[model samples]
Target: MAKYKIWVVAAATLLLLAGCTSLPGTSSSSSSKATKKLQTTGKVTDSMYEGVIDNGQYKTSQTRGLTTQQSNTSFDVKSLESGLLKLSKEQFPTSKYVFQEGQSLKTAQAQKWLARKSKTNTEGLNPEDNGQKDPNKRNPIYLQQILEQDYLGEDGSMKGMSIGLGMNQVDYYTKEQYGATFETKISKAMMTQQGKQMANKVLSRMRQKKGLSDTIIVIGLYKQAPKDSLVGGTFFAYGVSKKGSTTIDSWHELNQENQVLPVVNDEKAINQDDATAFNSFKTQVETFFPNLSGVTAQTHYEEGVLAGMNITVNTQFYSETEIMSFTQYIATAADKYLPRNIPLDISITSAEGMQAYVGRASGSKGFTTHVFGSY
Candidate 1:
């Protein structure tokens, strides 16, 4: 219903402009073209995604799912607040827009950070079936960090994390679902800005239906083009929710007898470092979920899977204010750094109260992590 309303309003605005235009000559062609484009709308329609192939099998599809975490903690509200304030200022220095209601600058930045780009204007990617491991697999920790830094306050403060997972699969979608594509590699700024605009519209609608609250986390899957094929973008939707002490760690311990941890995932290709600084982020989460223990972390490498463990002690007092504070802190710590610009903080607000949320989304020979945990 809300989507319909937005479309209606947008159409009305366009029609009003058309009514004011003098359209008997070249103006007629221009107006007609503009109207056709507007009618096309950047949104993917049901008919656009009718025949998609998932893993080689032809099937019709729709997208939907849920992932969340909920827990009690001992962190004091003051500590949480102090932590969140600091974290927010660092993660989102220019983030003046309210996260859930008006203005969303962080969302704009994040979409810009993740949108894809091609080197050649007319180049195309073959659905490479090399059977090689996917380089884009998101580490569970990486996903978590994106949330802490991008969505929560500076100290990881959040009231309560409200997470929602949805999936939208059309039978067939085309490049028209999204806007224009330049031949030369488009700049990240351009893609991110476009992505930001889309993200804001979706989030604003969610806010209207659910009420104005900063405590919401969402991850959704939209129809994606085939691997190497140009189509619309669809994957995850996450927002901020809450923060508590929970042991979150990521590391790579190669079985090889090299001096330091060998930068390898398996017996095959070896180059990408599995031990990024973000991989060692564990103690930070423990500050929220003290009783967190017996948890294990692992990465599926070319050889097999590397595993590690940690026991996070609830090292702080807990309260409403404390929980909110902790929420913001964890969100910041989990954000992704984009060189000089303030790091892009990903929001996962809904998963705040969930016990554990873990899953995977695979498309175009690529896969992304969908994991959430609480104590």
Candidate 2:
């Protein structure tokens, strides 16, 4: 069985945007002085994990398992960091990859900053308003920090370079509203364009950096939120020395083949089985803990095989120890009733915070659970 780890970061306050905006193109002629300012501005944090890839081989085709951390504001940067490190090692082994993390400014703050910089009227713009007249005209703001790290050769000469870039677009509506086919398609297309523009801006900035004429720049787009699931956004890589750029498709794209399957073993029968099992589990939870507000379960299948199961429970009144016990009970029940080899993600949200558990059935009647989230 593959061991899937859940990486959780502290949740920031969610800032809502009323509309989307066209991302502006960045100028490549900005002085090296400007590049230095870009590197110094914003809150700079140390790399979560950084070192040479001692494994000797990068896992390009490995399937990343499901995670419990959903996209709250933007794409998960921790996951992106992990992916970029692997890609840089594979594509530019001798080059040093420097990843400087960047964060999105609050909607109001960003609007004011943009208005002051451009000397334009940005009045009457509210990012938290979801009732905007035209959804297509709304543009969210993303502020990026640009920095370069050089890989030096034995003779103290610059061999190669890598730079980190970040951007985000706010989701105006909830996931339920985004479920419509047309809406999802339009949103994805717009985000993809925004991502491309942001990548170009990073490239332009990299060009301004001193002594980076021949370098490999890796650009990462953070996931923007107001989404239902953890799977959010995409990433891109550019080789300045090679004059080529490639957009790395995410796992969500790779799993598209499993979206639909032929009706075998009676689709309705399987749904009924899952519904019955889930209902029974919910009943047990409610019975054991009367304080639980509700329990909801949703199951997903691929080619008639159980692919995933999501359970959300309101844990407003449970203690930490009690929640842990409840999670174990649910895992044991899942192992008994649910199909094997599929992931089961349970989210327990309360006034304090959120706690998530990822459980997978193992040996005969055995289940393994990995817990995540701030709570």
Candidate 3:
């Protein structure tokens, strides 16, 4: 009945080892460069991330400050933020255009767009309430959230924009005023349609705000996971709106997918071979050390091919020697069991903290290891 959203997930990305050793397990110490003065620069990362330069300082998203965090999972948030930039590059290449957080979409405007549609505020993107108190009869909020990113030319002018629509696969709501919470599953077909339609409407409004009718706009439709999902959602499709248009001219489908380790369900396995490899790696670690808690992994894929994997190894031991030994063993196990020619990062963590780290960059010959505090 109301725009009440809750998100119970919050986490930071895995730490990138500051010190490490290359394959063959030879230890080496490394130090980072000295801090440099801020400049009016826009640096793009290998992950397709581009930052803006405002008065010699990099700026973050304006809409990000408005996120409740309780209403969305960190996985979904990360995927949306990163995936949108990656997709937008197809149209707004980093070579010519720089990346900036959506500045045209203000906090109040985004809040209004995310609110439930009602007579008092028709600008709400979600469907208007039907005067019904029954949860089943009420219209579910298919559109959960909206994200905006801007593309800027070298001259600091707006070149293009990318908009991400976060569609909820499950709507959490109450049957009546202050009643018990109930969830309604939203089918993929309905969610996609609503997202596409919302994109058109959003374009119209954006054009009105800053004469964006003459600007190129990218739209990313993301299907968010359930409220209690461990992993975030994936972008299923994206579209481009050419200049002088407020609607998408063409849509392209994206086949990016992610899988949680331990093979939650055999029937839902993304790839049987990959699962076998992960299982073997897990078995090797457990067999060597029985006191360890568990080992799990998350696989990322693009166009049905394994692109990257982030593995987490939980343990109960706190000894530095034990951690170093375990890290060395896992690096070997990963080489034997994990897929080759793909980026992979393993975090060995315990109640104390992250004990050790192992990683392999894409196209790299071998993995790198770093025992925390050793360097």
Candidate 4:
């Protein structure tokens, strides 16, 4: 099954400046005579989101079926195991296979595979060679490069099958080259059948393993463009067998397009809730600082939970003291109006520079405000 985890977004910026250093008590003339030099600016702006309001209308939807669980009966372990042993002994005598009882690929192993594939795919493709015309358009790495070693059995047969499902490869290639207007209906139909056939083959082989009687086998597939490293499509298929059964009973294929929001009742309701919260926060900031030129509030969510709330205010001018006070006022308002557990990120930008407040959502109650920026 696909692993569920919180997603965090990080943004970084770089600034450069030129200046001349002067020693304390140094004469103005001597200071002016010194050579100019580049200097680093000590300014930082951090932002975080607070949780969403507890609106009864808002709910999470489970649309993606990339993970599944099932049981099967009549699973032919003897036949499957025999095939695997034969394949190991004759087809691939020097391969290694790894078996694990999880839906998603192991994090560390996946990273190592991705790193190696990235290096190989980008090899010799430099700006001078015309291969770097577009970094994002570089040639796609083969699936084998990413999952081969992980699925190779020590005896040379396959340990687990990893297949890319969804649109047929031919139709995918055709559409990429000629757009969707081309006649690929027949090819697409053929491709779908092929995907099922391939899935069945892998499922049959995996069922033959010693201890997979009543468990689900999840095989993940990632579809990428011919020359792109990013996965554009994802799919999952499983073979289900029941305990004490000799044959497989169910087969499932989950494509990205077929996913449904099974848990979330209405996405629009959640969006409206976020908009309402942001407007309320924005109004409070404006009321506190009438002279503010412009102000905006944004809300962020993770797995349908309020993760952070961010507010940015712009003014014609600002002082260090004023910025600090403004941040404190906003923090206070956040604690009073927003949820207690999330974080609040407030930024104030003016003609001079910028300042920011990064702390807990419940104002500055439990955490100290970390304010840093140029004057």
Candidate with top TM-score is 3
Please give the CA lDDT of all the candidate structures.
0.24, 0.39, 0.70, 0.34
For every candidate structure, what is the RMSD over all alpha carbons to the true structure, in angstroms?
A: 23.6, 14.0, 7.8, 20.7
**Candidate 4, position 69, lDDT:** 13
Question: What are the models' TM-scores?
Answer: 0.20, 0.42, 0.83, 0.33
Candidate 1 on 21-83: residue-level lDDT in tens? 332221212123333211111112211101111233322111111111111111111112222
CA displacement after TM-score superposition, residue 178 of candidate 3 (Å): 5.0
lDDT of 4 by residue, 1-375 (tens): 011101011121101001112222222221122212211111222111110111221111111112111111111111112112222222222222222112233334333323212444432111112242232343321221122111223222223333222222312112244444222122334444444454454445445555443433333333222222111222333343344344334655533211111113343433455556566766787787887887654444434555444455786545667777877777777666655565555566776666665455333465446445635
In Å, residue 58's CA in model 1 sits off its true spot by 21
> Candidate 4 regions off by >4 Å?
1-8, 11-274, 361-367, 370-375
Provide the lowest-lDDT 10-residue window in model 1.
63-72
Which of the two candidates, 1 or 2, achieves a greater TM-score against the reference? 2
Alpha-carbon lDDT of model 2: 0.39
Question: Which 10-residue window in model 3 sums to the lowest lDDT?
Answer: 1-10
Clashes of 4: 27
Off by over 4 Å in 3: 1-50, 65-70, 133-135, 265-267
- Candidate 2 ranges beyond 4 A from true positions: 1-190, 210-215, 220-284, 287-289, 296-312, 316-325, 337-375
